[model samples]
Target: MLHRLVEPAHKQQHQFILDRLVGVWLTLGEFMGDGDYGDVIADRRVGVRVEISEGQDRYVCPACEKPMILASHRIQNRTKERFYFKHLFDDGSCSGVAGLGEKAIAALRFGQTKESVEHQRFKFRLLESLELDPSFTNTMAERRWVDEDGVKWRQPDVQAHCNGQRIAFEAQLSTTFLHVIVERMVFYRRNGGRLLWLFRDLDVSHFRLAEEDIFYSNNRNAFRVTEKTVELSRAGKHFVLECVWHVPTLTRGGVSDKLAHGIVRFDQLTFDVSRGGVPRTYFYDYEGARLQAEHRLAERAQTERDQELRQAFENFYLPFLNGELNSDQVETEWPELLSRFRSRGLGLPAWPDNPKGPFHYLLAAYSARAGVPIGTDHEDLVKLAHYLVDKRKHTLWIFRLMLEAYDQKEVMRRYDTTGRWLSKVKQYRDAFRRGDSHYMPNRGFDDLLCFLFPEISDKLVQAPGTFLGSART
Candidate 1:
């Protein structure tokens, strides 16, 4: 059955333990790493094992060339594991055995870049596509540096020169390792080096997706929802946003897909401070609501402004964009002006009237330049439909705007339902859950909010022929 409501988390300590089990949902409290046989490689052969320090069953020692069978048994109830079920093999299971419930961690050749393209080459291409030129090439990736203070570390990222200062880069993958990378960069900067994180394909392991739905019975089209949390604002409460985006590093989900040739791959914050010039993010303690509301407002306002900017491209700004407005012609012949019908068949939302907003100015200019007077005619609308439907790539500005708008719509819906009571909360709360973790009240939000937060359509974007998988977007 589907979960109807959520309750609070039982223990905050579990969150710390939970972060280590990077991939997949975990109600099981165990630190799982991918490898086998005690990180040992003998005669160039790799051995794998599964060891659970805590749980019903403990460790398993398999015989060489064959899965081991139990040769003895014991039970210990006072251990971390609630169940003391034991399997012993005195005959041959282990050459050496230690630790309770020990098993080899699974091994996955998870996030290797394509063999044909090196990471540096791909990054150079990406920078070139972005029109960025590096002034120097002192990359920090795997480079050892010893500062004047005897501090030493290796940079596993990029270091470039830009605009007369050194630029440091940490091309981070979307995993818990990101925290380590960012920490190193932070340390580097503290010791006097100009560095900026050149964020790569940020979305990787998020469980989210976007899909459009058509309601034939109601003669309406709607977007379907899922278990994804789309943050309307990039400035607040978004530490996990990068995790989903960084999932490109995690491949090998199944037996066939793990080794499949050329498998598909893919894939912010803010706040304020009471006094410091440095930014201080106000989290969920007391000031979270204010920060949340403010950022949302900023995003909403920004989206509207972006739409206006798009309009301006077709109107007054088109000449500037195309380098033609200043070319001449103080006053063109009336016939010539009348004959131009470039954007005659386009439609869009009405230009906003908030003159104080920069959006208004941007829209006024662009739409006018293209002769698409903001949905002035059926032809204009048809032109717009064609542009949106037939276009291959989506506009980031437009995408951000739409996302912001959708977020506002959801916010409005939730805001109105604030005081309402959920009938199934108690019933669902009473339901039993597996594991040693206790129940908390916030998982209640998890139950209901999970529905509100739909999955992303796409996750990380990887190079062609890469085995890394992307998000569903």
Candidate 2:
């Protein structure tokens, strides 16, 4: 199941890891300095080095080369944690047979704990802590506590009796599935035991660590109180796990309020509230981080697009600014347009408010109304009437120029790109909706959209460049 989800890049990385593990395994055996004489050291020789036992180092399957975990098992009546290489996959072709079964491997990978050195250390530290506690002197590591049918319930990293309560302290470092955690919790609680899950610090990308609630605020919130956990440990208090509030910033390629990790007591966990009465499930909190990254990427792309548009706008209008352009030839071919916008009153807002001003706005609005790219057709009438209802702006005398434009679509583009010219004028909206072909009835409509008189000049601002594409940039 884990292998199925591995992306191409991750698969390559996993292959590299597998190769390294295999290399280490191939070099660990020392049988008369000859590779063929590989032999397994008996459990009686605790510190001996052999093909199977490589001192205190990690091991991998001799056949598949998948990394293995060193765990405890009773051997010759002595139980101790030892270097035991296990296969990661259930490949029958592999001659090695000492690793965990396929189901166990699947559970371990789901919990994101495959070949985790940090997880191993945390387990050892928890055991040591419990051993030092007077109330938990009966604490033991890797104890096979069984169920009524002699079936194995759970082999916690460290199990102890604290204050007359059986506790299972788990240093959860991997992305364990929710069902697994819930199952273990229910199993422990039913058999007179309580489960406490602990997490490492905010190392978000450790085996895709950030995708879990170990650092999230909602649902499966886990506090990251590394210092507090240590302080409490020193004071011999009941261990408290940490929780964090992972706040995502969705702005111009940056985030705000990023410090969202903290500590929480065991009782504060939601699972404890209903542990015995019913089962509770939790989810991963990594979506916040994923969304933030996506937003930042989108903002960056938009910025790049704006820059491109600005460059194109400059190139197109540079000839006019340098007096190298002449619309006389164009005017002759499209006489109606030249006559309609010939007057300054009929034009869009001028610079320095807008660089290309009326001319650019006219082209962009026409292009948008036609659903065509800019400069595609110079003679098509701007569509205005079709979009008047959506643009929700009052009719303008400039709209009368629809004799040379599409009345419906052009009207919508003008209203959208033009500033809130008729936002406060209720009668203008009513008049336009009724399809009145008369003069704009409201005074604000004429003042805001048609005239540049001093009384309403203060309200006028540069409209958006929605239709102009890069020209507005």
Candidate 3:
């Protein structure tokens, strides 16, 4: 639903028409004066027409006070569209309209600090309409309020108290910064008042799913809009507002349920508590959209972290994998590698010479992190666990560190057979005592090696049981 206001629009052509008309010398009567432009006002107000014609009498440019005349021309669209504008004399006299382009046209249309007469007209109308509601027992326009302590103060455009709740209605016709809006809202709320933002036109260009617009109601925990109010104003030929509920990230089902309380507007010329205050945002499916957004943020953060770790794995962890490092080489490099991984937001798999030695644990961690499975099946893990728990005749220590490569939740959810394997392993661990297995002192070495280094299981079968004993102990 996010969109940018694409430029080089037909509206720009309208501005060109307007600017050219302004450039021609005009009689005092022809000029609409400050706060009004016929080109702009006529387009918005139905039944009102703008008639720009060629002026015969000598005229003075408003910009340079040089001789000018209304110039008529046709613009090329799909068809030739007639447009008339004021043309200044080109006797190398007037500096006005000398170097005009799209920028100048845009400035003529939009770059104005003073409030247009139309904007003022709409604001006053809305204020008068608000006063008509009896529920707003206390209402004032441009009211300045100071708290009893005199520490907090505010001057709202239109302030009212309805049913003991203080509210300020702001009708915005131009763009405002997010921080300023938030600041005003916070200041009002802190003094026990709520600020309602009413936009003459919603800036769809700035709308984003993740960001909250001015219409977003923090108190009600929803984005609220008075659709009826907007429609009512439109009927009076005041202002037009196009409201859009952005829902690109939301799911399909139960979207209506989350929006039940989001739209507050007058129903049948009467204000009701149920429908006329502030409407909940129908755009976001409350929990679903929030969860999705949070998931995306989390995924992005994890991706950033993973990239760092992957870089470290490539630079540091890869060299240790070829089984070429000596004990001293490993001892010297292992700490730095662990530190680097941790610094880069990657969790170390195990302590050095932990349940298994550093090499086995590193291999498992690398395989898991790299998404490269070492080919150990679920049954092999069960067999390894069973052999360790049930077959050992004597034991210095017991270890249960195989299957460290896989996530517990993933194992539980993705493989139904893993549940049975877990139960079998648990059964043996719970029933067996220390010296009650067949393969004493060196039990489960082959199975452990097979489970840990499945890619080289045949070679690992010939590996020393001392390594397995060292791991178990």
Q: Each model's TM-score?
A: 0.24, 0.35, 0.38
- lDDT of each model, Cα atoms only? 0.28, 0.42, 0.42
Question: After TM-score superposition, what is the CA distance of residue 180 in candidate 2 from its true location, in Å?
Answer: 3.5
Worst 10 residues of 3 by lDDT: 266-275
Q: Compared with the true structure, what per-residue lDDT tens digits does model 2 show for residues 286-370?
A: 4446576777877688657545543444443443333454667323433443233343234323331243244433333334334
What is the per-residue lDDT of model 3 for residues 291-390, given as tens digits with 9 covering 90 to 100?
5666766667766666665565555445545445577877776787678656654445454445434333344434443433222332433343334344
Q: Give the TM-score of candidate 1.
A: 0.24
lDDT of 1 by residue, 72-173 (tens): 121243211121112333453444222322122111101221111234553444333223222334443435555647866544444544445554443322
Off by over 4 Å in 2: 1-63, 66-104, 107-117, 131-137, 148-150, 175-179, 204-218, 223-228, 236-240, 246-259, 263-473
Candidate order by decreasing TM-score:
3, 2, 1
**Clash numbers, per candidate:** 79, 29, 8
Error of 3 at 316 (Å): 11
Give the clashing pairs for model 3.
24-86, 261-280, 262-279, 262-280, 263-279, 263-280, 264-279, 393-440
* Model 2 poorest ten-residue lDDT run: 4-13
- CA lDDT, candidate 1, residue 116: 15
